[model samples]
Every structure is written in structure tokens, then in C-alpha cells.
Target: MFRNIVVGLSGGVDSAVAALLLKRKGFNVTAVFLRNWDTADETGKCLADEDYKDAEYISKKINIPLVEVNFVKEYWHEVFTYLLESYEGGYTPNPDIMCNKNIKFKKFYNFARENLKADAIATGHYARSSFGPYLEDYKPGAKVKLLHAVNQKKDQTFFLSQVSQESLQRCMFPLGEMMKTDVKKLAVEAGLGVIAQKPESMGICFIGTRTFQNFIPQYLENKPGNFINYETGEVVGQHQGIHCWTLGQGCRIAGSSEKLFVLRKDIKTNDIFVVPGTDHPALFSRILITSKPHWICEEPESLIDSWTVLNCEYRFQRNEKLCPCRVYKSSNNKLIIVSEKEKRAISPGQFVVLYLNDECLGSAPITHAGPSLHSLGEGEITSDVDDNDGLLRASTV
Candidate 1:
């Protein structure tokens, strides 16, 4: 058990409850409010100030010491820059994943250990962590194992997959085994009514309520492009920018009775290819290639040399059921995942977290998606495109 713990309080009921629980458990508890974003929202109001006020109020109510630290520069450089660049390069990057890896767990954990002199850092993240065998030693209880939270609906293991194992060993998730409903009830019973009823934050932490289209243009130049029909090769509509759209996004194709979805984006031509209907064949892919993966503990022995078949969830949040898949390595050392069933919207830049039952094995960033071998009727898959595109335009053989 940890003797001293610092909880990253974000002016939310979850963090407040975590701090209270840590205090009740007799661990030295201190609440730290992280100021990772200093920009004002669309309404010209600084959201961080409001969050700090709530955090201060909660700390006073809970009778715990509160500290505020700024990580704005770190976040802007490490997380925001990558996010904008990924979109500019026609990929949908997950900033939350990067934020956890670079800021919350890495930067905040270091500060707590060095400055606060804390034994471990805690957060309201709904993911469980336990000790396991080290990756290199294979000695039992030598490493940390990241697992899914008990509250499956609120489980955040996917976003947390990128956290380093060393940081995870010193990290505590107080809400791991508690449901969101129970946390709210506990907060109210503990005389924290204001925070108990507060609504959960949505969208990116810094962007707040502003739309991505409005916020992105402020950072990168928008290049308008034609919206082409994938099947007929006809330009049916036009878009303000290809970066504004992502794979499987519903397009309001002017004059079309049926709803159209983005099937692919040709970066060289600056054209977005669309197909009619949400369940278009082009939207589903059976093959996905990923960049070098990072394992939480160790890569399973079954996946080391030969192709190993495993059950995985392509997008865990939307689709809960596991999809059977086989994992292999390419000559270039990238991972190749072949799903038995077609997966919808296997977008580049999103993460594909692998799991064995409840334990999170590791994760990789999706770099390419193509139609399954069975899905192709005649011609073989072609790679006749620039590598900068970051996605393969799936076509039938």
C-alpha cells in the first residue's frame, strides 16, 4: 500500500471521490489541479480558471492540501502539435492517449514523486493496475499489469494503453473498482453535493465546446477539395478541406437522397471519396496495419515469431464483442492484423488495443486499412500511392 499519494483533481466528482477515498484509507492525500490548457473557450472564457475554482472548493471541503501546476507548454508541444499534424496529414489522432502518456502520467507523476515527495500518484481514471512479471526478467510480481476497470461502461484502459509500465506501477486508480453511479452517491453522502451533480466534460479538454472545424483552422490552413464518388469516379460534391473529414464520417452530399459516408481520402489529388449509405462496403475493412506497438507488460509469447490468432476488439468503446483475428509481423517490423469479420471505420491514427480476457496486453496506432481478402472479388490489393497518404485506398481486384 502507498503511504503518501497525490491525486490529480480535475474539479470533477470522480477525482474528488478518489481523494476522499484515499484519505479515508489513511494515506497522506494531496490534491493537485493540473493546468494543461490556458486558452479561452469559444465564449472567450478561460475554462481552466473555472476548473481550478471547483478543484479549490473540493479541496477545502475535503480538508486536503491543493496545489496547482501548469503544463500548458508541455501539452502544446507534445500533444497538440502531434494532433494538428496528424490531421493535416489526413489521420485522426487521439490526443487523449498522447495526453495521458506525455502529461498526466509522465509529467504529473514525476512532479508528484519529486516535488510532493509522494509514494505514488493517483487519478480518477477508470482503469485497474496490478503487479505482474517483468517483461525482461519473467519474475513474478516484478512489473505492473494494466487491466480493465470494473465499471466496463466507464473503463478508460484504451486511452491509458500508452502509459509506460514504470509509471503505471506507481499509479493508482481509486475509481477502478467503483461504478460512476456509486461514486456520485458517495460524493453526495460525503457533503459534496455541487460536484456530485456536475456533468461530465466532453470533447477535447482544451477545445471545450468549440467545434473541431472552427478550432483546427486556427492552427492549420484549410485546403478545399472535391468530394468524389468512389464507385463512379464522379465529383458529386465539394468539401472545405479533406482534414475536416475522417473515414466513415457522414457527408451531406448536396442533391443525394441517400446519406453518404467518407470511404477514403486521396491526399495527392486532395479529394474525398464517398459511398452511399452508412454500411457501405468501403467503410468496412478486414485488414489493418499498425506502427510499432508498445506493450504494457510484455508481448505474448504466442505473438513473437509465428502468426498467432487472438480475439481482439478493433474499437472497444463502440463494439463490445471481441473480433477474432490473427496477428503477424511484416518484413518492415510493422504489425499486420487480419480480422475474421469486417471492422467498421478502421480509421488511421486511432489506436487498436489488444487484450487477453480482462488484461490489456498492448496497443498500436492504426496506419493502414484495406478490404479483407475475402471481400475482394477479382483483383489483388495495390499499394501504388505515396507513403505520406498514411492510408491505403481499398479497391477490388
Candidate 2:
């Protein structure tokens, strides 16, 4: 029921169907082609030509104006730079979360509101939004409440945890209530051109399918190191570089029949220790310590005597569940989960989101463990508490 809306058009079926849905709702929708990268490899066709053409065709079919916003510089400076630094510093990074935070929501949101004069910005993200009944003690004019998307498999709320409450108020996600299959069916039914069968892009940030190592060499000089066994400090393998491998990787140890997983990294000694078991018990823990907490709910007035219960998700696609937590800022502000039944692979640089039932309470950066992927710069080891605990965490290199 809103007019003057700006929808991000990715030249894919999801955004294409989103534009159609907004049009059906009688909104003055304008599609914008966000130029996220500049891959100029001539042989690889590493450019945005096809995507631009698709956007043009879709815009024409939808009878809406199409705009282009170039964000290549921001992607490089903010997201890619951090990714490179995190690797060199010996920690895994999530560029996708950074992309959502700095690019899609922050920069893109500003452009739509200020330059395009849009009343609201919409995307094809699989998350829902609604206005909640205001509480007597609640702050006035708090109209935004984020909810999980209908298609549970495709839910993306984890990446969106960083979105400010102010931005969430003006943001809209039309595909949240609908399943991916339904969106595809609508695209075909609406007679959208070639994009009706376009495949979803699962490529890494800017560089696409190329290994992070390939791209890292362009920005960093490699430092080779020794790969040692956990029990004995005997050298069993040698790595091209310590930064090339990520924590939790089950890489084959050369010259040994025993498969080894990275357990610890000693940057000072340039040693990468490998453990023996794929299901090593020492790998999992049940306690988590997080820092830099971002609360979407009412900010707790100091951590004093605050014993509150909340639900948390360590990764997207995780079901929300109850966990007893307390915020303690007496020394380095952090959220401590005291009563989680399961140990999780709380990766050092990933996010830890808190929820109340389905509504997001807040989120924090995972700083320490209760079962997590432990990385000591040169190596990593994953641990899970009993097999039945519901804390959601995913392993990524």
C-alpha cells in the first residue's frame, strides 16, 4: 500500500518476482541495478553486461524506471579489505555479512532515501517485517519487528542482524512471506523473460568461485609454515602458507595414513598442529563469550542484576530456541550464555545472535567458546557438545 519504492534488482528470479509483487500491490516501484563488483577479466566475461541487460529487460517488462548505483569502491575498501586483513591476521572472515551491513543496507539504503527520494527500500531477501503492538513501557513510534521468512531453508535473518532498528523501520522484504518455489512460479506466470530460469549466484564476494588463497596473494605476501601432529611435536606435513588454510578444515596430512584436522596454530613458532580425530571430544564446548553486542530490543539499562532468558542463533537457517543469558560489562562488555545444553562451534570472528522466541533480541560477536571452532592463528579444531543441542553454527573457510 506504499508508493515511491526502490527495489534492488539483482537480475535474478527473486528480485524479478519481488518487483512484480510490489507492482501488484499498487506501489510505484523503481528497480535499481546495484553494481557490486568490477571483474574486468576479458576471457572470463567478468563484467556486468549480462546482468545489466537482464535488469533492463525486466524493468521494461515491469514498466518501471531502472537506476544504477555503482558500489564497487565501497565493496573493495570496506568488505574485501577486511576479508584480506582477517586472513592475514589468522582469523576467518564473513564477507557476506559485511556486504549486507555496509553495502546493501547502509550505502544502498542512503542512496535510495536521499537521491532517489524513495519512501521505502525493498529487497528480495527472505525475511519478514511487521508492526508490533506497542508496550506501555515501550518507546513511542517503534513500528518495526523482524521475523523469519516463510521458507525456513532460505531464511536470511542472521546476515540481517546488524541492520539498525531505524533502517528496519523503512525497509521492506516482499518475498519473506512466500517460498522460493512460489517466487519462481510467479516469475514464470508473469511471463518474465530469460531470468525466469536464471540460476541463483552462490559465488563469494566479488571474486566469485576463485579460492580465497588466489585472491589473498594479490594483496598479501605468503608465509610458509610447519604442519605438526597434536600429540607429538613431529613434523608430518608442510603448508604452502599458514593463511591458506582455515580453522576446522579436514585436510589430508601428506606422508601419513592418519587423517588430521587443524587443532592449533602457533604464529610465533610458525607451527600448525593437527589432531587425530574427525570427531574429537576436546573440540566441542558449551559456553560462549561474545563482545560488541548490538541489541535491537530495549537496551538493558546497565548489566546490573539483569538475569534474562533469550533465544539465540549462531548462524542463519537455525531455529530459534531458549537459552539463559546475562550481560556483564564490568570488564569488556559481553553477553554470557550460562544455560545452553549443547556445545557449538562458535567461530572466533562470526556472529552470535540472541532471540526471544522468533523475534530477534540482539546479537554479538563470538569472542570465546562453549563448543566452537578454536583457532590460534595457524590452525583450528571444531567441538560440539552432546549431539542433540540446538545451537546453530556453520563451518566456513
What is the TM-score of each predicted model, taking all chains together?
A: 0.90, 0.83
lDDT of 2 by residue, 47-79 (tens): 576688898989898899999989989988988
Clashing pairs in 1: 378-397, 379-397
Which one is best on TM-score?
A: 1
Clash counts per candidate, in order, are 2, 12
Question: Model-by-model lDDT, in order?
Answer: 0.80, 0.68
- Model 2: residues with Cα > 4 Å off, grouped in runs: 41-43, 132-140, 300-331, 338-345, 370-397
| Candidate 1 lDDT over residue span 102-157, tens digit each | 99999999999999998788898888876421112123457778988898888888
